[model samples]
Target: MNDVFITKAFTYLPNEPVSNDEMETYLGYINGAPSKAKAIILRNNKITTRYYALDKEGNPTHTNAQIAANAVKGLFDDKFRKEDMELLSVGTSSPDQIQPSHASMIHGELDMNKSLAINTASGLCNSGMNALNYGFLSVKAGVHKNAVCVGSERMSAWMTADKFNHEAENLALLEERPIIAFKREFLRWMLSDGAGAFLLEGQPREDEVSLKVEFIDFYSYAHEIEACMYAGTEKQEDGSLKSWADYPSDEWLKQSIFALKQDTKILDKYILVKGAESLRTSFDKHNLDPDTVDHVLAHVSSGYFKEGLKEEFANVGLDFPWEKWFYNLSEVGNIGAGSIFIALEQLMNSGRLKKGEKVLLCVPESGRFSYSCALLTVC
Candidate 1:
């Protein structure tokens, strides 16, 4: 079996615009935190700006999957055809439905024949990495010459900014709905609608830049599953607000970190020193050391997480500057499975990847309470 390598990557950022400063003002009114507040707390304890999808009439527009599919098509040159793609897979958090899957929709849009295999996989933030693993294994097994993997979600479609922003309903159930306040705080940096696609080619030549998937070294602690969970959804009686949770952000953060450390430990045996540098630095109390890594890409939960992530990286001696990487959550917001894909696109566009270079891709999922990391090298 030969190695599988990513040949192309692209992203679809929604058309709507929402600024970080505007979100902070909204949060100030909601939490009464401070009149000057401008940062909305996001997944990784960060602040970010997000773009919303809206119709001409300002109704929430849900079209992230379409945007993602379109982005995938844009990656190819004139030489490739839909017929050339042997498989298509979607890794998304916000699915339009449980059956048929978003991949089927993308396949249809691409006009792929019925002979092509299509499927969907959900692993929260790990969706993209998991899909990559699947594609890597499949190509190595000679199942296909090429595979297309996409990570997309329209998280903004899950809630209406109008209803959630208002405080009238929340005043009545303040104590019982404590999570509502947290949700409102986090909503500002929540994932937005976007799609990220990666093209994986098999049977690569020696001259081509490619890296084989030796195997995924996943380490997970059994007790860490309860750290994060998806808050259930229900219809609002007055349609003023919806979506609530049961816990605070601190609890979620602690559990998430614990799981990440536990699971990442599996790599220690394979690359002892490098694994230590990655694990300790990423989990460091301060920042990641600049010298320990060549480049780093992380799931953008918020500005706070980015800062902490950068700090930890610096602490570990990785030489890259915090600003060298693209953190587009402020621009496109969180794109769930698409976040890493978006970062990869930015990295490629910058021409930063070179042969023999190593990059760290980290992802942490909220709903499934999972953390996954992929160590990729340019061949």
Candidate 2:
């Protein structure tokens, strides 16, 4: 079997600076609340800071394709001609349009070969993992020697002046509004714009060291598919794109547990078996142990969600070496599918992964209720 590896990775944050404090104020008004007190609270609780793709007017600038194009260029400081690339994939929660896919525009903007194969995938926050899976499979299949995977989002345009204003008021006025406040708070965590990209290729020889990274195995489960979703259609006059109901938080958590149950084999022997005999059975299936795994690159889907995983992982006897694995979500906000790649870049940049070290990349997403896990080894 062919082994696919990551050759390069890059992230493009907003060129203009927006402090976490300032962003809290900005988002407070976006939902129409705009009070000094509430804004301060949001800044303190929701996020630290987030980036965006914008123009002079500060409007949501650049289409999803533009973000991907600029990000690819950012990944390669040395001049690389378009003809050098063989395949391209753009994974995003926010697509540039309903059709044609963002890959077409990326290929066009980069002036890449017209013959190059292109595809687009949207699986919410898990899209990055899905993209990595595809890139690895393509190289392993001998279809292409090199592949580019990108994740980008532009949520600034997703909210309009009116919607923004209303969200703010709802945050302040509605006394008994648990659901609305929850939705508004969650949306606030969703940052805007920016893009990240990764270059994948076949296994690199020991001689060329800087970018070589290897893929191990992957597992997924969609047991509770209806827990959360931003689906269905809305009237065009709604200003920003159509919005959907946030899944009940309790249900979402339940689904997450269901997913862990379905895919415990990959994690078996590594961590101490926790809970019922069922969990022990799952552990035995994979022959994994928590202690054997050196680092964990987890899905920081939400601050709350990560906390849940920590408790469960500990309960199951898996000690997550948080220090070894980098987490910057508090600094940059949640970038959806971009989260994992951004985290991966941090791991590589920190020099954390040594030769043969084991790293697990895990993501749990709302809506389509998909949970994905990738076992990777350092080259």
Supply the global lDDT for candidate 1.
0.57
Tens digit of per-residue lDDT, candidate 2, span 94-201: 776767777887777775535778878876776766777787788888988878888777665553333344433443555633123333334544455667788877
TM-score of each: 0.70, 0.75
Query: Where in model 1 is the C-alpha error above 4 Å?
Result: 21-49, 60-62, 162-179, 203-222, 225-227, 233-293, 310-326
Model 1 over residues 1-379: C-alpha lDDT tens digits?
8777776777777664666555433323433343221232343444345655655344555565677678788767754566688878778766666566777777767765557776677756667667766776777788988888888876655444333433423543454432334433344455566788888786433554454333443333324332233433322344222233443544343222111111222222222233334355444433434354466677755554555555554555544676445565656666778888888777766666677766667666644245566656676
- Candidate 2 TM-score versus the reference: 0.75
* Residue 186 C-alpha lDDT in model 2: 41
Q: Each model's C-alpha lDDT?
A: 0.57, 0.58
Model 1: lowest-lDDT 10 consecutive positions: 255-264
Measured with C-alpha atoms, the lDDT of residue 209 in candidate 2 is 31
Distance from true location, Cα of 368 in model 2, Å:
3.3
